[model samples]
Each structure stands twice: as structure tokens, then as C-alpha cells.
Target: MKENVALIGWIATVMTGVVAPALILALIWKTPDTLLRTGEAGQFVSATASVGGFFSSDITTVQSTTGSIAVYNTFSAPRNQLLVVRETLKNGLQLCAENKPDTCVGLAGSWAGDMKPVPHARHRFAGLVTGIGNSGASLWLLIGILVSVGATGILAQHVDREGRRRS
Candidate 1:
């Protein structure tokens, strides 16, 4: 009866320590960091776009009282032409121009109250941003799992030996 109990305990300890650790390591090994980063970036872009879309109709006109000379004017053309230009500018700013360090800093400092400096802030779906965030989280989780598994494996071996001795 004592031997049976010891054997059961030993098996349980192995499962808790050895198998669990192995599973964690396997998961970590399967998920690469770059893949996670890509996913996170995608998610962030998606979420930003989704929320941006909701507020698209609520366009706020910025009246520049400071009299900055404009380099380009869409107002000189028809409404459709102006719309196309605006769309193009928005896309360009969101994807390419926004990431430039000088532009980012300048815009962030220049923008008025409650305005976030998103160089690439354009309306789109939330999938990209959510995916990116999830991927990053997954990578962190994998790292945590790896560390936990390593510690638990050591503990399990110790417990297994102790159980064997008792048996």
C-alpha cells in the first residue's frame, strides 16, 4: 500500500515537472520572435485603422490662424480631385512619411491638444494591430513558459528522486 502511494506520487510528480516543462519548451521552440513581431505590428495597424474609420465622418477642420504658406492646395480643383489628393496624402503619410524620425518629432511637438502623433494614422481594419499585439504577447508568453518549465523540471527531478527513495 505504501509502495503504491509512492508510485502514484512519483508519476504525478513526473507529469507536473517533466512533461509540463517539455511541453512549454516545445511551444517556445515553435514560435519565433520575428513572426511574433510581424503579427504584433499587423494587429496594431488593424486596430488603429478600425477605430480611425469610425471617426472618419467626424472630420475636424484645422483653421491655421498662424498663416503658414501652403506648399499645395487641393481646394483649387473639383471636389473629386481634392478627395483623391487627400486620400493619396493620407495613405502616403500613414505608411511612409510618418515613420521618419524628424517628421515624427516635429508633428508630435506641433500638433495641438489631445492629438496623438501617428505618422501612419489612417483609417483601416483592426486586424493588423490586434495580430501584432497578440504575436508579441505570444512571444512573451513563450519566454515565460520556457523559464517556468526549466525551473519546474529541476523541481520535478528532485521530487521524483525523493519519491523513489521513499518507495
Candidate 2:
């Protein structure tokens, strides 16, 4: 009787967990792209994001480096605004040559809002992940949860209590 009751409880728990996520996914799948129309609301959101991104993060308004240029704001945060205008190359300032236009060197490229400073961050490794993460914070939260779960799993493997001992 006890085993049967426990089995039923386990099944219910599994069903609730699986069904809730499935239903949510189905709803999202059925949702139309036009659900959130682009107009005043979109513009307002973009404006808010630009202002908020600038204040919340260590984003410089304008940055010019040897290989690229960067501007941090909601609209441009995901990618560096690299524009090339006609100019005479008589001389380049040490600051410009060194790419130290204040927070400019750190940005490597578009994936980095400039160019990648990290080791071996080749083009193959899709920038969409980092780009989205850089622009929106929701990705960070999802990554954090994944990392926490993995860490907890590792701890569970190694940090077990002592086995029961009998005299």
C-alpha cells in the first residue's frame, strides 16, 4: 500500500513538472510574431533599454581603437558601431594607435562590440549567444541557473555524508 501511494505521488510530481513546461512551450510556439507590435511601445522599450544599459553597465558613450570603434547603448550594445570615413593618414596619436580611447580596447568586435580579447574566440563560435547576453540580462540569469545546477551536481558527487556504521 505504501509503495503504491509513493509511486502515485512520484508520478504526480513528474507529471506536474513536465506538463507545466510543455504547456508553456506550446503556448509560446502558437504565439504569433505580431503579438508584440512594433510602434510606440517598442520605441519606448528601446529608449529605456539604451538609457538603462548605459547606466547599469560600464559602457562608454564613444570608443575608438586601432581596429574598430564602439558605442555602448541599448541599440548598439550588442555590436560595435564600426564606421570608416575618408581621412588623411599623416599621423595617428599614441592613444589612438594603442586603442586606449577609454574602454575601447577591451571591446574586441561585434560579438564583443568591437573585437574579441579572449584567447581563440574565432568566428566559428557563434556570437549570437554572447551578443544576446550582452544586450539582454535574461540570458545571464539562464546561464547562472545552469552553472548553479552543474556545481550542485558536482558537490553532490564529492560531498557525501559518511556511511552508517554498526558495532
The CA lDDT at 64 in model 2 is 31
Candidate 1, 167: how far from true, in Å?
2.6
Task: For candidate 1, give the lDDT.
Answer: 0.32
**Candidate 2 lDDT by residue in tens digits, 1-167:** 54455446545544444443444444433433221111110111111222434335443333333233332332222233232221111111111112222322222123222222334323321222233222233444445455555555644443342112211
In Å, residue 99's CA in model 2 sits off its true spot by 36
Report the number of clashing residue pairs per model. 23, 5
**Model 1 compared with the native: what TM-score?**
0.25
- Candidate 1 per-residue lDDT over residues 46-162, each given as its tens digit: 101111244232222212222221211111221121111011211121111223222110111122222233355442423232332343445655655565566557666766877
User: Which consecutive 10 residues in model 1 have the weakest lDDT in total?
Assistant: 35-44
**TM-score to native of every candidate shown:** 0.25, 0.27
lDDT of each: 0.32, 0.30
Cα lDDT for residue 29, model 2?
39
Error of 1 at 150 (Å): 0.7
